[model samples]
Target chain A: MFRERLAQDAARIQKQFDLVLGALSDVDVTQAMSYATQGGKRLRGFLVLESARMHQVDIDRAIWPATGIEALHAYSLVHDDLPCMDDDDLRRGRPTVHMKWDEGTAVLAGDALHTLAFELCTRPEVGTADIRADLALTLAQASGAQGMVLGQALDIAAETAASPLTLSEITRLQAGKTGALIEWSAGAGARLAQADPAPLRQYAQALGLAFQIADDILDVEGDAEKAGKRLQKDARAGKATFVSLLGLDAAKARASELVDEACAALTGYGASAETLKDAARFVISRDS
Target chain B: MFRERLAQDAARIQKQFDLVLGALSDVDVTQAMSYATQGGKRLRGFLVLESARMHQVDIDRAIWPATGIEALHAYSLVHDDLPCMDDDDLRRGRPTVHMKWDEGTAVLAGDALHTLAFELCTRPEVGTADIRADLALTLAQASGAQGMVLGQALDIAAETAASPLTLSEITRLQAGKTGALIEWSAGAGARLAQADPAPLRQYAQALGLAFQIADDILDVEGDAEKAGKRLQKDARAGKATFVSLLGLDAAKARASELVDEACAALTGYGASAETLKDAARFVISRDS
Candidate 1:
């Protein structure tokens, strides 16, 4: 049920993204931006909309933040795929922005998308002034130096470190790299509704870690074809990952535990949160 | 007097920026971000503060947006200096982010700083939620595809075009690439005070063009040491710049006309806008 809902939400967000880019001139950067935003699982958007549904927040207002988060995610991917970064050539089974167009287009497209996220967050229809302000502020925090970017920096440094990262260090890195944005996506509804975000925050925290572990597990075991991009590259690079530190079985077990914690954190929402709980469980089972 | 005031404001903004980055633990990205942001003229920051002062907006509140614009400008410069972009090796007489910290660090640092600009925009202490929302939304419009990014993409596309850019094409590109952010900075004061931004907007439209023209003039004739970056490269590349298209004399006359128009836009503010008018005049005379 949750899987289908997530797919549906992803499709809806795709339309939202189209609207955002519809009026843009047919330039390389705009085309690259539109292409970069397409075909993602949009798990973050799903979290935002689902969390909003749980809080009885209107879908109209929720859509902007949902689309915004996904755009931010897409920007991250586009930049990560640059030759100067992870240097990946493919994303979502197609050539990345840098590979398809050029590095300059990719960089500028990612940057435009980055600013677009905040612009969407500040849309007058998103919510009240306070909510808009809060959303923009938190989105910045989630994606900025102390969050995803910091994590990327640490991940890069770890590769060249004299010693391999410890289990805890990997955990810390993943939390920033993957957890921050997920947490922000999950908390969107509570922020929009002006409700207490503690429960949703807890759920997202656990879900984020579980999602990273699942990614590591996939890199170790999943087929690259199904993943739509490179896999097993972490181990090949000799970098410490969740699987490296915990071993396969222990990593799998830890992910399961986190999924359980994620679900339990949503108990306050009762049956309304079943989809989120299912989503948490789905994190470990999905092939991609 | 205006020059000294701009310099003082630049110093104050530099201190504020330091406060933003000082607490982060040592990391490649953090260091790269700091390096990228250092030693700029802080012209945009000066615009924000001076504009805000024109409307009696508190400096305390104005400083956030002022600092935010500088950070955004710094991020643009960092990415602009990427090997796949401008391929520059020095900025403000210091090593470029990619040169000093590697491409990956430069990319991530620029990304983090980009997000930091929005984070600072939504700062609670900056203004009411309405004001913050307005700033964030307008900033996105100014810096995104329809604004600075579009300008950058156009500039890149121009490099390999079969023909050099026409005078009108160059004007349009400059409006986006350089004009958008400057206009936004100039309007910051009006936005903060919720006053009429029309006059300031008109002023900025003229001032921004004059500023770009001055830059082109400097590229043709200024000392590289004072400029702190490479110059005359545009002519070497055979790119059609303002100076190239209009001829040196015509470009100078056009710039003087723009300064006059910029000053004229300040008539609504009377004596309070004398500094801004002086700023307009200074654009054509500065060595760097």
Candidate 2:
């Protein structure tokens, strides 16, 4: 029954996202926008919706925030693929926006997506100005150089250094680069649902760390066909990874332990949080 | 007396900008942020103070909004200097952020600056949340692709294309690329001053256009030494130019006419608008 409900919510939210993406299409910007938005796992959106459900918020009220998170996630991917950044030519079996058009267009498209996220969140009719402002601030903190931007900076810096990262360093990098946004997605949904901040933040922190470990493990062992992109690029890049440092099996075990902690963190929220609990399970269980 | 007041205002605002810029210094992101913010005319900052002066608003109340606009303006310049965009190697006699640091640093620095703008505007002590939100939306609209971003896209597209652009096309490009932020800076100050939207927007639009025309004229005739950067590069690149289309003298004359129209638009606001009127004259009269 929970699975069915999750599917229903996903479908409904995906349709709303389609409308959001469709409306963004302009003659000059449409192609880049389509490339950025299409074929993502929609993991961030799921986090927003599922977390909102945990607080008994209706999916309709959660959809805009969900879309906002997805837009930000997509934009990060777009910039991450730039020649000077991760330099990946392909994403999800398609040419990246930079590869399809030019780096300038990709950069601008990413920028537009970032602005669009804030714009969508601030839509006055959807939520109170305070809620919108809080969400905007939360997302900005997660996405800016102090968060994801700083992570990317560290990643780039790591490329030139010969020093091996300790576990703490690796976790710090992942927390900023990957975990920040994931945490923000959950936190934003909770904010939209008007949940208590203390427990919600605790839950998000654990889930975010678990999510990154899962991603690191997937990069090591996940199938290319299922993952829809090149696998093992992380190892190839000489970048620090949980699987590389902790060993694959240990990384998998750590992810499971983190997920358990994440589930435990949500206990006070009651049965409404079952989807988020399942999401934690899904984060570690997925091959992709 | 007016010149002294304007100078004092500029110094005071620059001090505040220095504080904001100084906060980023300890972080690795400082180089790019410094590169982007340290120099330039502070025209947007000027507009912010001048607009507030029209309503006899406290300079302290106006400082945050001015800083916000400057932040936005700095981010735009950083992104504009990226290789995929303007590819500018030098700005203000120094290498641009992208040229000085790597492109990734430049990108992150721009993103951080953009977010910082909102952060400054939304400081709880600065104003009410409603005012902060309004300022953020106004600045975002001006900076986003639909406004400045789209203008830049068109500017770039026109640069590489074989098609001849009409004066209307040039006007549209300038309005978006350069004019939108100018308009926002003016309007945001007016908003802070609690001026009615009608007269404020009218003055803003005209001033914005006049500002662009003056910039175009300066690019043609100004000395590189005085401008603090290379001149004639625009012509060398065969980029669209008002001087190229209208002849050097005609462009200069048109810029002066725009100043007149811009100042005339402020007539409804009374003698208190003298700073803004002087700003318009400065726009057309200055060598740079």
Predicted structure with the largest TM-score when compared to the true one: 1
In candidate 1, which residue ranges exceed 4 Å CA deviation?
none
Best by DockQ: 1
Q: Report lDDT (CA) for all predictions.
A: 0.92, 0.76
lDDT of 2 at B287: 81
TM-score of each: 0.99, 0.94
Q: For all the predictions, what are the DockQ values?
A: 0.86, 0.49
* Model 2 CAPRI rating: medium
Model 1's alpha-carbon lDDT is 0.92
lDDT of 2 by residue, B10-86 (tens): 67777887777776424556557765877677878877777777777777878987877787788888888888888
- The clash number for model 2 is 3
- Give the per-residue lDDT digits (tens) of candidate 1, residues B66-114: 9999999999999999988899997899889888879888889999889
